[model samples]
Structure formats: structure tokens, C-alpha cells
Target: MHKDRIWNKWLFKVIGLELVKCCAEFAASVDFKRDYLKILLSDYLPESDPLKKWFNEGLKIGLEKVAFILNNDNQLVKISDIIIDEVGLLTRNIIPNQYIKEFVCTNYSLPGITEQNVLQIFPGSEKLKHYGAKTLSQSDLKKISSVRPFSF
Candidate 1:
């Protein structure tokens, strides 16, 4: 039951290239054969493209922060080129993890205003209201850490 394996091709391709190099390096321990070629084509291709580099880097950051839940050497995460190509218009390529989480939660909490440029141009619109942008004062944001448990 493989449900549309997206990154497997790239992974296999990578694996094949390594195997080829490995066999060449240690020819005594390995033999090149037609059956191996079948496994090579089926399992891996050398020039497979990967997800976007920036997004991959971002995932690497997260994996590091969380005690290396994943192998950073392997691009386990999938970032489509379509999305990468659409960066800046739809998203920034170099956002940090805190910014990413904040973006997700803030947007999910208010569908009207999540990274949309509604607030910059149209200040007090309904979308801005949903985002609570008006209420979020510079002072309040700056002093969020200093505010007491029940302080006003």
C-alpha cells in the first residue's frame, strides 16, 4: 500500500549513485551485473531532484531542535518545486522555525489574515480585526514576557 510515494524516486536515485560508486571503490567485494542494473533503475537513479533547498534546510533546523528525530543527511521532508518557485508571492524561503510555527498557528486561528498583505494597505478591515492586529500594540508585544499571570 504505497500511497503516491513522492520522494522515494529521489531517494532511490541517490542510493543507486552511492551503490555504483561503492562497487567501483570495492570491486573485489562486489560485481556489476544486469540484475543489479534492474535494481539500480528500479531502486535508484543518480540525477533525481530533491525538494527545495531552503525548505529542506528549515526541516533540518526543526529536526535538530527536536533532538534529531530525523536524519538531516537524508531529505525526509517534501517541499514541492511548485511551492518553492512561488516563494515571496506566497511565502518567504528563509523564515525561521519560530516564525513558521507562529505563521501556522496565527493563520489557522484566523483564516482572514495569515501572511496576507491586507493589514499593510487596508488597516482596519475585517481580516485585520480577525488577526487582532489592532489590539496587538507594540508595547503589548514588546512586554509580553514581562506581563504577570493576571496582570492587565
Candidate 2:
């Protein structure tokens, strides 16, 4: 696991890479429509990646268009939404929950949603295999919430 390379471990940052990998394996099973991909590009891609941005954006647009079809907001309160929302939290690599939680606290209340539920919301690391290598652990969880997500 590239534990050192990972900044926090939020999965959204790496979703694009993972989706690309899946395009090769289960081309039909996934939900990326060419149109949706284009929309994703114009909306989600950062302006700074330069060449990579160009390549990835073009590819996604084509991939979406090639499918000849495509399809596809947030007052995230609660750690679950926070975890899922801040997934961009790991843009380059893993993101620490500490960084993410602050955002969550701002929008959502902690009274209802708990950490265990939040962890459940976290997509498995399996989907994130492409971005650096890393395994999740209890200590890593600490990087997220000083205490457990469900420490009620």
C-alpha cells in the first residue's frame, strides 16, 4: 500500500482512475455513458492538470460520445455524507479524515448519523486500487476521526 503517498484516503479523487480501469474489464457493466462522461469532464476536471487534463478530458468525452449515448449537490450533513462528499478530499492521494471532518461539521449535525454508518458509506478500497497502493486499518481510521465514527 502506498500509505506514504496517500494524503487522506478519500476515494472520489481516485474514482476517475478506477472507472477507467473498469472500462477495460467490465465495459458494459458500469454506468458511464459517453454523454455523462462529457458532462463529468466539463464539470469535474481541474484546469491545472495540463496535458493529463487534456488527455483525460478528451478520452472521457470520446468514451462518452463513443457510447453514442450518456447520462448522469450537496448539503452534506452527517459524517456519512461528509465521508462521501469529501471524497474529492483525496484528490491526489489518500486524504485524512481530519481534513474532511471539518467540512462535514460545517454542514451536518453529528447527533444522528454515527461513524460506523459513515464507514459503511465509505466505498471499499478495492475500487480505489489504481490510485496509489494502500491498505486500510484501524489506525488509518484514526486519521479520519480521532475516535471511531460511531463512538456514541
Candidate 3:
């Protein structure tokens, strides 16, 4: 049982690191497809894993950001609707609580991230309560006021 716990922790860590790398690369590229992340995640995790739920939530948030960046408010709304529908509003709210808490507790070191700058990179706890798990942050929300295509 102890060994299993250790293995699971290691697995989550590996998956988390890979997901972050993939998300960054996908976000920066012009050719990113919305389903590409789903496919990649499915390859790494089983369908019923709770971690998959959290990762998918992150993917949805990223997609919303992309839609906002492309000036497609309609698509953003659709994405948000899909999230609320798939997870239900309540579960959607709870999902982010565990997700963000685990993320911070794991102490996954990102480049240039430190105690001093962590809040700047990721919103502080108080700010997180405002954004919750459903959205990214205020700046992200502001950017999404308009939406556009994925074209560079």
C-alpha cells in the first residue's frame, strides 16, 4: 500500500510536468487544436481518473483563453457553457479547489518562480477565491472580452 502511494505520487508528478510543458508549447503555437490536449491527456491517464478531471479543467480554461485571444466571444461562451454543462456548476466549482491546492502544495518549480514572484505568476489565495477554478484570472477575463481566430 505504501509503495502504491509513492508510485501514484510519482505518476502525478510526471504527468503534471508533461502537461505543463505541453500546455505552454500548445499555447504559443498557431497550429494548436482544441482536441489535441484531450488526445494527449487520454494517452497518459485513464478515462476515470480524478486527475484527468483536473487536467481537463485546465485544458478548458486554456481553450477559453485561446478563444478570447482570437476575438471569438461566442466560442468562449460556448466553451464556458460546455464546461458548466459537462461538470455541472457545483462540481466545476469544487474541482478547481483541489486542483489549485494540489498544484501549489506540490511545489513544482517553474522558471523564475520564487516566494517573491509566485503571486505575480499565479494569483494569491485571496485572488484565487475571486477567479475560483472556473476561470484563469482577471487579466485573462479582461482579455476574453473579445475573441478571435487561432490565426497568427
Candidate 4:
């Protein structure tokens, strides 16, 4: 049991690090910037606009579910909220860099928010919190990962 606990801790740390790295790479990509612009435009623009239609129709990505077992309670919890929180933090850190800012501005013309007002814009966690993180039993975790092969 003690060995299992130590292994789980190590595993979660490695997974978390890999997740952060993947997010960083995705955040730096042109596709991410385009998707960001689409979201912004879709939210703020008139419903009838063609760009809004394009955003609604063209950019839906399926959610990837990740679950973690809590050490204290031994309850499984979906960690999407934690990932969302971390992504917000990463975005905040990345956007301030002059090179990234220049690249975004040079490539895209955002509505309302521009290069001059860019510093003021940040992704809000409240918007990302569509659902509260859910706690699950070990059995529930098994059922979820059963469809896909479960791995350590």
C-alpha cells in the first residue's frame, strides 16, 4: 500500500508535467490563436455575422476527460477544472511576452481588443467553470477508462 501511494504520487507529477508541456505547445500554435480569435469574435459579434457562423460551425473540439484519485479521501475526481485553471495561468504568463504579443497582433485583427488593449485582456476562469469538478468512486473511474485502455 505504501509503495502504491508513492508510485501514484510520482505518476501524477509526471502526467501533470506532460500536460503542461502539451498545453504550452498548443498555446503557442497558430491554430490556438485562430481559435482564440474565433471564440472572441463569436461571443462579441452580432449573431448574423458570417464570421460568427463560421466560428459556431467550424471550431468544435471534443472535451478530453481526465480523472485523478484524491489521496486524502481516495475519491476519484475529474481534473478538467484544474487543467482549465492552469491553462489560464499559462495564457496570462505567455501573452505578456513581447514576441508572442507581436505575433498575435501582426497575424490577427481582433474585434474591440487590439494590440494597444491586449495587456488588459486575459482569459477568465469563471467562463471556463462550466461544470464543477466531479468526485467519483474507483468503480466509476474504471467504467470511464474501460472503453479506452487504462494505463498507469
Question: 4, model 3: CA deviation in Å?
Answer: 1.1
Clashing pairs in 4: none
Q: Per-residue lDDT for 45-112 in model 3, tens only?
A: 44376555444555444443432211122122112221111222123343333343333333332222
TM-score, each model? Answer: 0.18, 0.21, 0.25, 0.25
RMSD of each: 18.8, 15.1, 16.4, 24.1
Model 1 spans with C-alpha error above 4 angstroms: 1-3, 28-152
> Against the true structure, whose TM-score is highest?
3
After TM-score superposition, what is the CA distance of residue 146 in candidate 4 from its true location, in Å? 61
Cα error of candidate 3 at position 149, Å:
33
Error of 4 at 152 (Å): 61
Residue-pair clashes per candidate, as listed?
Answer: 3, 15, 6, 0
Q: For model 2, what is the error of residue 150's alpha carbon versus the real structure, in angstroms, after optimal superposition? A: 10
| CA lDDT scores, all candidates in order | 0.28, 0.35, 0.34, 0.33
Cα TM-score of candidate 1: 0.18
Estimate, for each residue in 1-152, the C-alpha lDDT of model 2 and write its tens digit: 33233332333334544444444333333454222222223333554534444445554433333322111121212112212322333332345555445434543443343232233212222322222212334444455655335332
Decreasing lDDT order of the candidates:
2, 3, 4, 1
Query: How displaced is residue 141 in candidate 2, in Å?
Result: 2.6
27 Cα displacement, candidate 4 (Å): 1.4
Ranked by lDDT, the better of candidates 1 and 4 is 4
TM-score of 4: 0.25
